[model samples]
Target: MKTILLPLLIGLMLVGCSSSPSLSNSSSLYQELNGQSGLERLVDAFIQEIAGDEQIFHYFAKSNVDRFREGFITHLCDVSDGPCEYQGDNMIDIHTGMKINEADFNRVVELLINAMEAEGIPYRTQNKLLARLAPLRPEIIHR
Candidate 1:
């Protein structure tokens, strides 16, 4: 009975696995982003974008640029499956008191998109990276 059940379950699992198209391999997204130096450039560009935006600049006015830069670089790297681990505060903890509204949060996203464009990341790759990071929205926007 045990042997028969095991084979039956394995067959069902194999059928289920093969039923859907597999997603693209995401492990190398870090390399696609051009690795460490590219991530640094992205962070720097994002910072500059935030600095230049009137509405969004105020949110980062009192924040330390160096801290933000390093933390963001690490976070991006980790999310893209790079070698670095994120060592910064969790998103919720860092954004809890910010009272960030949806519009402002979206503006920040737009700034990030702009930064990716500046870094010459292809549109499809940008979408891939954005999808990887999209789960952080709830943690960041605390109403």
Candidate 2:
């Protein structure tokens, strides 16, 4: 399934949950993400990853690269319990008319995992971050 403005929805998974004690309410995951600068780097790499993916690039080809970068970084920080807030649109609002489906949403998750791996984030830290992201899934897919 394909969708429009998928890039704007990239960081939607990074917010809306804070129940996890290890990563969501603590700065440990943020530290693992290398703080603000590291989140920026991760967003940059994620954009590059999306740009290089033939399957995904077309969806992002018309996106505002700068906005995605900044929003993604801020969301990453917020999601990782860093000192930042995700000031972008809510998940439902951002993805409502896009018609995003399960496969595409999962693909984006895969891309995020790839970006995290490229950033040298450990498997443990990565899992923690993913776990934090689980609850927000319902707000995103098929919206």
Candidate 3:
């Protein structure tokens, strides 16, 4: 009985070590954001809110919405430590001629917060993501 128990415990330990890491074992913010699907939803909510806001609608007038959504999701995912690559232009290049002011940037941030709320993302998680993104303001705000 003792010999059998020893082999069983060793087998269990080997199985545990051989198992692949899952979301449950991951501490990535991407997992916290629910991965690609959740990020996609968050981006959609943000775009929808921005589309109706007079102050920012014009900014997207000449843009490709679908591509923007995809890239935004990728960007957010990458920033959140997810396994996604951002294919969009760098923030500096993207906003170079946009002349986005502090007020404009703030408004977008507000809209993003609203979007996060709309998507049922917790406030703490939202703040975590926002904190990660706050450093990009210098590149995004041209004026």
Candidate 4:
């Protein structure tokens, strides 16, 4: 009876493991976002929306606009488990001397949320992306 019970338990555990989600592969999420092509669309839409917003866009305009835009997309893609490498400066050094206050950061976040919404990214996905990006706040924020 003990031997029979142990085998049953192992089989159940194996079944459970097979049903669990793969933590490392974000391919499913990428597919939900419409894959690589969708990434391109989302990046383009996000940049356009942010650029049109005067408050945040001005700050961006003063900085390296092209590099900033490209870096943002690269970071997003890398975090989302896409096949892209982020080759930008460290967040802390990049944001240094910018004198970005909390209010400015919040405003940029709002614009980013809007852009994500415009792209029809679901709340769950947005939250997942935000969770990944949140840690960079300390490095990106100054003043």
Q: Tens-digit lDDT track for model 2 on 1-143?
A: 34645754654544524334555345578898788888888888889889888777777777899987888788878988888889899878877866777888788889989999999988988898889887888898887
Candidate 4, which ten residues in sequence have the lowest lDDT sum? 23-32
Model 1: lDDT of residue 76: 89
lDDT of 1 by residue, 36-90 (tens): 9999999999999999999999989999999999999999899988999998789
lDDT (Cα atoms) of all candidates against the true structure: 0.90, 0.81, 0.90, 0.77
lDDT of 2 at 132: 86
Q: Which of candidates 2 and 3 reaches a greater TM-score? A: 3
What are the clashing pairs of model 2?
none
The segments of candidate 3 whose C-alpha lies over 4 angstroms from its true place after superposition are 1-26
Tell me the TM-score of each prediction against the true structure: 0.80, 0.77, 0.80, 0.74
Tell me the tens digit of each residue's lDDT in model 3 across 7-80.
Answer: 99999998998795764365778988888899999999999999999999999999999989988999999999
Q: Candidate 4: which stretches are off by over 4 Å? A: 1-29
The candidate 1 region of ten consecutive residues with least summed lDDT is: 19-28
